[model samples]
Target: MRVNNFFICISGCLLLVGCAGTTKRPVAPVADASSVQRPVQQPSSTVTQPADKDKNIQIRAYEPSVPKAVAPVHSSAVTSLVAQAQLLESAGDLTAAVATIERALRIEPRNAHLWNQLAHLRFSQGRISPAADLAMKSMALAGGDIALKRDNWRLIARARRGAGDVAGARVADRKARMLH
Candidate 1:
C-alpha cells in the first residue's frame, strides 16, 4: 500500500509538470496610440506673420494618427453553419443540410468547401442534375484541385446514371478513375 501511494504521488507530480509546461500565457492587447510626442505651441508674437509663411511650421492638431486598417475578424457563422450542415447530413437530413449550406453560400459565396458540401448534399438527395452543376462550379472555382475534379466527375456520373445514359456514366466513371 505504501509503495502504491508513492507511485501515485510520483504520477500526480508528473501530470502537474506536464500541464504546467503545456499552458499558454494570455496574449497582450495591441497598442493603437502613437508613441510620438506632440510639439508644444507658443503664443504668437506681435509680428504679423503672413498666413502662408507660418502655415507649414504649424503642427496639425493632434489627431491621433489613424490606426492602420485591419482585416475584418473571421466570422464564426461560417464554421457553425458548416458544422450544423455536417450534423444534419449525418442524421440523413440532406435537405436541411442543403438549406444550411445555401445560407452559408450567401455569406461566403466564393468558398469552395461550401459549394462542394452543397453538391454532396444534392447528390445524396438524388438531385443529380443540380449536383452536377454545383460540382462543376466548385471545380471551376477550385482551379484544378484534384479532389474537386474527382467530385465533379462523380456528380457527372451520377447525373448520367439518373438520365439513363449508361454509356455517359461509364465514360464519366472512367474519367474519375483516371484522375487517381
Candidate 2:
C-alpha cells in the first residue's frame, strides 16, 4: 500500500512539473525561410566637397590639448607633522622622526615631498637599499617637479655609492645632471 502511494505521488509531481511551463493560449506558426523579406540597403547620394575659404569651414583633424602639471599642495596637518619630524631629527631622535614622518605619510601617502623626506631620513640611518628604493618612489610621485626628481636622483646616487655600486652611482649622478 505504501509503494502504491509513493508511485502515485511521483506520478502526480511529474504531471505538475510538465504542466507548469504550458499556457492555454494558442501558439503562432513560424514563417518559412522563403516567405521572409530582407531589407534593401540604400546607396549614398551625397557628394563630398572641399570646404570653401570664404565660408571659413576648413576641415581639420582633432588635436587633444596637453595637460599642464600643477604643484602638490600640503595641508596644515601634514605641514605641522613635517615640522615636528624635522625637530625630532634635529634632536638626534631618528626613530621618533621616522615614526612621525610615517604618521604624516599615513595621512598623505601620495605627497612626493613626504616620500623624499622619508628617503632622506632612511639614507641618514645608513639603510642604503631602502633609501634608494624610497627615493625612486618619491621620484615616481614627483610628477612634473624636476627639482624634486633631481634631488631623488642625487639621493639614489649617494645610496648606490654607500652600497659599493660605483658604476650605478655614476649612472644615477648622470641622471640627476640631465634633469638640471
Highest TM-score model number: 2
lDDT at position 45, candidate 1: 36
- Weakest 10 consecutive residues, lDDT, candidate 2? 58-67
lDDT of 1 by residue, 1-180 (tens): 999999999999999999989878899987666965677655343344356854644333433332342222225998899889989999988888899989989998877667877887887898888887887787777654666677678778888898898998999899888764
Q: Each model's C-alpha lDDT?
A: 0.77, 0.88
List ranges where model 1 is wrong by over 4 Å.
Answer: 1-75
Model 2, 120: alpha-carbon shift in Å?
0.4
lDDT tens digits, residue span 1-180, model 2: 999999999999999999997879888999999999997544334344556755544344434443354455788898899999999999999889999999999999999999999999999999889999999999999988888898899999999999999999999999999874
Clashes of each: 0, 0
